[model samples]
Target: MNPSQNEVLTPSQLIFIVNGLLIGVGILILPNSLVKITQQDACISTAIGAVYPLYICLIITYISKKHPNHNILFLSKKYLGNFMGSIMNLLFLIPFIFIIFTVTPSITNILRIYSAEFLSPFKLIIIITGVCLYTAYNGINLIGEICKIIFYVSLPLIILPLFAVQKSSILNLLPVFGSGFNNILKGSIETLYSYTGLELVLLIYPYVNDKKKIKNSLLKGIFLTTLIYVWCVFITVYYFGLDLTSKSLWPVLSASEIIDIPIINSFRYLFMLSWTLILLRCITIYCFIAVYILKDFMKKTDTKKIYFFIYPILVFLSTFFTNEITRRNFLVKVTPIMVIFLVIYVSFIALLVRIKG
Candidate 1:
């Protein structure tokens, strides 16, 4: 199975895929997390936080440009030697699996909280996991296509907060440098959880049709994601004020309650429904990466058998966290670990690749 025989991703599809990866269930809670630390300046914190992932994307793009048509797994093997590369690959795969556990449960928890409180987590996991497995087993091209569709479908919902802006108190953001830059910087840490999934580009760059466009696609995707994130934070802050936004579990969803559409009696439900798509898109990417890594490890071209075996374990693990607080704690505690691993792995590889050349 030559990589080229699989479908090639257009630059736009690449952008959507990265964007989908960046903006997941994180949006629902980001406002509260930032507000609690930064107060009225959460939007500022969001803008500052945006820089980190872009810098990461730039580094990834640099590496990918140096090794076009090769993914991180391949480069690690080539540059790090078989023994060391296999170790690095395992390091990468562990977090990829952890992502499935952390993100899948969080999304299911959100759906249960907002849409179906009566529904059990086990049932939700089964349904969501089934969909993710089906999508991932198809291959990168299908994931790219689904990501494009999810991106467009989610755009209007992402902007739905604009309708409530009139009700929002711009004055709520007074004393713009609230509690100084220190708190803003602290709040930026919260934003990292939101930006976690963009690292998918390390695997994605190889499958892109026009390698030259990778940089542009990555930049555009990050920019778009930052814009949406900032918008969400701004709307949540403006609509709820600092005190309410800080206290609220999910300021974005709570703020959506203000949107009253004649066609739909439940705008909040509609917003949550949109989130189902957004979250599913994110989960699918993580599951796909897991399958992708397993296939690479086994030297198997077809992932159907591998996916079947892995998907059930993913589903079972996803049900471990029974509540939102537990799910959030898992994300907060583990995100830094994954980020640290990614930084160390990429920096080490970059240094080695440079030294070797």
Candidate 2:
């Protein structure tokens, strides 16, 4: 359905949507990835790595502004012609579909390892995918509402990181910039996966009320996320040091354990609980984008049929990865390609649209 005026999202909702998608399971290992290469300068690396998502967001926003009434699917076919556009649609669709598979097992495993050992894998998969499907079937506006609710509610828990600073030694962050610009740059490249999900904006841009304000809204979202990432890295490095940060599987989670609040029996559990909400938001948004894209590509007015057919396959594919190594390998191998294709697809489509005009 074409978004009605009432369905249009405000800047705050847009920010919630973007930030929710951008911050997912990647945050857990981000400090380790940056510290492994840049050591104490991981924060600097995080700032630099943010440029990729920033640039991509600008490109998508620019394209959206030029075609405010149409979504990416319409723009692609209009500029690239049916055959090539259909090919591009399929290419873009792979990442959205694969994201469900990649994230489903990962989030489920995190719950199993850190929070809910009693929740069986089958139950976790069904509950997560089912909730996502039901949400997607309602439409993007509902997803935006869920995101707004989650974003505001999670503030208290997310701020728990501030308590971590008390346990950190400023000395641990000593000798900043010691990693050298080249090393920090290399580390920045490793953090690309953390910035992967902003492409969701391209699909949902038409739903945003103020098209002229998209660049401002997107930059705000990206900047906010950058602050969060740098804060996580700073606290983790300041507490754990480079050696320990590099060794920990999830430096942020380990760092959170240092917060000794009497009221909260375990800060780590609090972090995990809040993080599960964030991941659930991410998963739901991604599923909506996937079904939305397919529905548009197939020229269907409703997504109900597509949701039913696609989510079951998503459940089956998610189960294919039985262990952590396989999941890690799948992410490492697939993410770069998806990122590269996204860059090419957005740039090429934007260029074609400009030339034709």
Candidate 3:
């Protein structure tokens, strides 16, 4: 079914929604992760990684233009047939489900370590998931609104890292490309997981008010995301140097800790508070997309009822990885696989659309 008037989003809202998704938990630790592989050239790796999303945006734009009325769910079923299409749709849901599983735990762990050590994981999970459920249940229009607000509110936090520039050493990044072509490529691959949320555009394309602007919106969103990521990695490496950044679990957080405002004693705390909202937006978008896709399969059920079932399962699954190491390891291993599946899935779908047309 097509989106109602209430569900339609403007081009700017679409940009913010995509940005909100792309800039979540990944930003917290990306500097550390990239530094481990690309050393001082982590920023370059980040720029390289953005190409994946750029490519996806182009492919999705083509597919959406060809089939203006249908999202990926209906498109899959239309071209691939009931059995194979249903299977593909089910596989499509895996990444969103995986995101919910991995991101919920990761966000809780970050909050506990950085802001709310006093609270238990279950309590934090309840708070986070509660907000996510409420937002997701409201539908994509509300989620888009929330994302736009969060995007503007969190925009200032982007410059918080710039406060560290005065103390940063330019020498840390001097030997650029020292990581070699192979290592840079590997680091770029590592960043593919961070760029996962861009695919949500495929699902939401039908909801955009100006379908013709979707391609520009996607490019702008990816461009904004790449700039933020590159800035984070560049600033972290400049501030901490290669050795220290490689050791930091959340280097961006660590970098923020150094920002000394006149009134605020701990900028890190302020950063975490603001960042928690952005993270919530990310989870909420994922939850909404998952529920939206599921609605296609469960045509008779209400969305709220689906969320009731989904949230409980999410809370239960999030409890599996009790510590940071396990959660990080699980994401590290699984994300690459998810990335591969998404690449193949989008490419195959796009190819089918081309040939059939």
Candidate 4:
């Protein structure tokens, strides 16, 4: 397991993995949150929020292509020495575990509220965590293959909105700035968490087959993801009105629920089905990243050996938070810190490599 320096995944496979991870159950909550950040120019704000991450993808892929064989862990350790590298690596790893524990409870609450009113969140949490942990234990290469399966589930997840367009009123967005242009950018940027999964490239680039294709795939990914997100936001805004869209947690699902289909019955159920894949993919991708980072640090042994130890830590830590609101609050507080680390982490590493070269 000496870094698996030769394991390189294709850019198409990487695109699916990143897309599957980014498009998650959060799609349901964003409309409401964006509105709260202030009922603004929904379409423009959503579109702008989508663009920021695309640029971020460019920066990461450029550096990763230049140093295709090295991961952030190696770069941090190399330039800053093991002590500083280990600290940053540990902080990075903390977010993954924190996310796992946080998101399971949140999805559990969603399932409880909308799908199964009586099911136990604890049981659902265990089952979801078990599947993700199993995939993660297999190592990075296998994880990429599983991502292909995730892509299939996600195909409809992206396309299902077309059926709802007929029912949407173009007039709802008439003023274009019900809340003003500046507020639109302000609100949408706050909800930019939609693009969180792009960072996975830092871990997976070391395994991509053609590092050059990584940038192209990232561009396609950000573009595709932004389009889907903007459409979802627009649909939510158009169908429900800013006030209602802002109020509902699952706005897209709610919008679909009310629209009538001729022969087919429940579009809401389809929305839920798509979201299940979203939830599973999100958790699994991050779990894979966390496990890989752990393997890199444990540097002395095979990742397969260390993975078993990692699963128990996830199970134990997840028990502290039992509700969605609390978990989301935790995610909000920690994510900005993670972003800052990534900025510093990616920049310092790139600078070090340039100096070394």
- Per-residue lDDT of candidate 1, residues 122-178 (tens digit): 888888889988987777788888888888877887787676577767899888896
RMSD of every prediction: 1.7, 1.8, 1.2, 2.6
Considering TM-score, where higher is better, how would the candidates rank from best to worst?
A: 3, 1, 2, 4
Rank the candidate models, highest lDDT first: 3, 1, 2, 4
Better of 2 and 3 by lDDT: 3
- Candidate 4 per-residue C-alpha lDDT over 137-182 given as tens digits, one digit per residue, 9 for 90 to 100: 6666666677777667666745666676777677777776778767
Residue 182 Cα positional deviation in candidate 2, in Å, after optimal superposition = 0.9
Tell me the lDDT of candidate 3.
0.87
After superposing candidate 4 on the true structure, give the runs of residues whose Cα lies further than 4 Å from its correct spot. Answer: 1-8, 38-40, 300-305
Of candidate 4, the 10-residue stretch with the lowest lDDT total is: 1-10
Write one digit per residue (lDDT tens) for candidate 3, span 227-279: 98898888889989999998988888888877877766877777887888888
How does model 3 score by TM-score? Answer: 0.97
Backbone clash numbers for all candidates listed? 0, 0, 0, 6
Question: What is the C-alpha lDDT profile of model 2 across 1-357, one tens digit per residue?
Answer: 268765677777888888888887788778987887898899899999899988888788778877887877877878778888778888888987887787887788878878778998767887888887888677767788888888777768777777657766788876989989899899888888898888768778888887888888888889888888888888888889888998887777777677888778877887887778888888898888888778766664556778888878888888876476688788889889988988888888778768886
In candidate 1, position 191 carries an lDDT of: 87
Per-model TM-score, in order, reads: 0.95, 0.94, 0.97, 0.90
